[model samples]
Target: MAALAPTAQAGQGDESRLPKAHSWRQWLDREAWRKAIIAIPYLWLLFFFIAPFLIVLAISAGTSQVGIPPVIWKDTFPFGTFDNYVFLTQDDIYWQGYLNSLRNAAISTFFALLIGYPMALGIARASSTWRNVLLLLVILPFWTSFLLRVYAWIGLLGNTSWFNRGLTSILATFFPFWVTGDHIQMMNTNFAVVLGIVYSYLPFMILPLYATLEKLDRTLDEAAMDLGSKPWEVFKDITLPLSLPGIIAGAMLVFIPATGEYVIPSLMGRGDSPMIGRVLADEFFQNRDWPVASAVAVALLAVLVIPIMIYNFFQAREARRGST
Candidate 1:
């Protein structure tokens, strides 16, 4: 009886171990690697974006104070008394900031497209050696610090600078009276801001455009040309349509950052009604109004993210329809 009892106990232990071994095998399934790899980006976004957003949102609901942190976190509501948002509506500065930022960003994006499209097209058409050289030239500015590039523009556009002096000399031939000033009023204006933005972000616009243009089927262009299509017609009909994705991508890249830009506009633009980023900075640092700053930050996020989300939704819908 004792021997039988021992055998029964051994049999129970073996059965118990079987499930654990099966679970261990299942855990090592091929899909486990894929899941781990796919989790990386999601984890990155969660940590960088979601966590910081929640912290900011919490602070937005708090009242401003004369403290080191300058914010009084509230457990009441994550959006404060909503007075900050109301204040934004009541104030002209906030509206001006938003409008000016959008206008500048849009204008810069347009100019970038006009300049970048031809460059991208030429690069795409170039031989491999020239293509590499041109690409290096395009990205060479990035080797220097961005701040240094913007400061270089400052020197070039400043009232007493030789570049402006030369520009004045050239313009005097066309408009002698208007060019009476020693240097053009290029600096301390939206022109400088736009120029800075375009210079800094033009590479962003070019790279994506080049990527798209390079992938286009040369045969289609050749066929169209053979059928008595003029170069302009072929480009307008075929090239433009195919490169729309790159255009949109480049525009978004330029527009989004330019809208929130602080340095260029602050250094060069009129300060009476600065961009939203400048406004947000002033509220936080100068005004010591943390709650208002947070509100501005949140509204800025919404302004940027909401449109993107809606656009993505519609795009996904279109893609699904096309797939169907």
Candidate 2:
């Protein structure tokens, strides 16, 4: 009876040593690695993107003062003043800058799309060897520094540049009266800015369009042709509609950043024509008006975000329809 009792006690002790179902550490050990990997991107966005945006939003709602951190926090609704936003409307410079930014961005995007769509289409249709070569050329500009590329344009467009001299000489032969100078006088103009923007961003417009177009079923076009559809008609019905997603993606990529661009405009645009980014920089640094700068930043975000959100909503709807 005593030996049996000892064996029973040992059995109970072995059962107690086994891991319990409700053990937190055991559950954590099972899920921690899998979850951690999945959470990486979300964690990155929370720390980098969301945190910075929230900080900017907080600063935008604050007041400007003479301090290390110029924006002063206020413990009230409508935070500091609506004055900053009001100033945007009242001041002509801000209005002009905003308008110019939009105009330049729009023009640049149009040119990029016009040029890129064909290039992308060609790449999509080309043989594998030629596709690689064409893609390399499209991406070749990125190998050099962006600042260096812009600087190169400065040399090319300068009044005394060989390019301008040659252009002027060519024009002189045809329109002799109009060619009054040795140079073409293209530097520091809106045209220069647009040219620089298109050159820099063309690849961005091309790559997405290529991806979309490459995946398109060649059979669809052939089928349409068999049904007596003309080439242009088939393109209008099949190609354009199918490639819209890429078009929207490329346009947004170009327009959003181009609208807020400072460097290209600073280097290429006339002194009188300022963009919104330059104005934001001036407000923050030169004027020492953090509140106003923050307000401008916030407003710009709003303008850009609304269109993106609308696009996303429609895309979601389309996706849902497709699934259904």
Top-TM-score structure, candidate number: 1
* Model 2 alpha-carbon miss at residue 244, Å: 0.8
Tell me the RMSD of model 1 versus the true structure.
7.5
> In model 2, what are the clashing residue pairs, if there are any?
none
User: Model 2 over residues 1-324: C-alpha lDDT tens digits?
Assistant: 777987777778698775677767866887877889889999999999999988877777777899888878767676566777887888898889888889999999999999999999999999999999999999999999999999999999999989989999999989998887788879888899999999999999999999999999999999988999999999998998999989988998899999998899988887886889889999998999988888888888887899889989998999999998
lDDT of 2: 0.90
lDDT of 1 by residue, 145-171 (tens): 988888999999998999999999999
Query: What CA root-mean-square deviation does each model show from the true structure?
Result: 7.5, 6.6
What's the lDDT for all of these models?
Answer: 0.90, 0.90
Count of clashes in candidate 1: 1
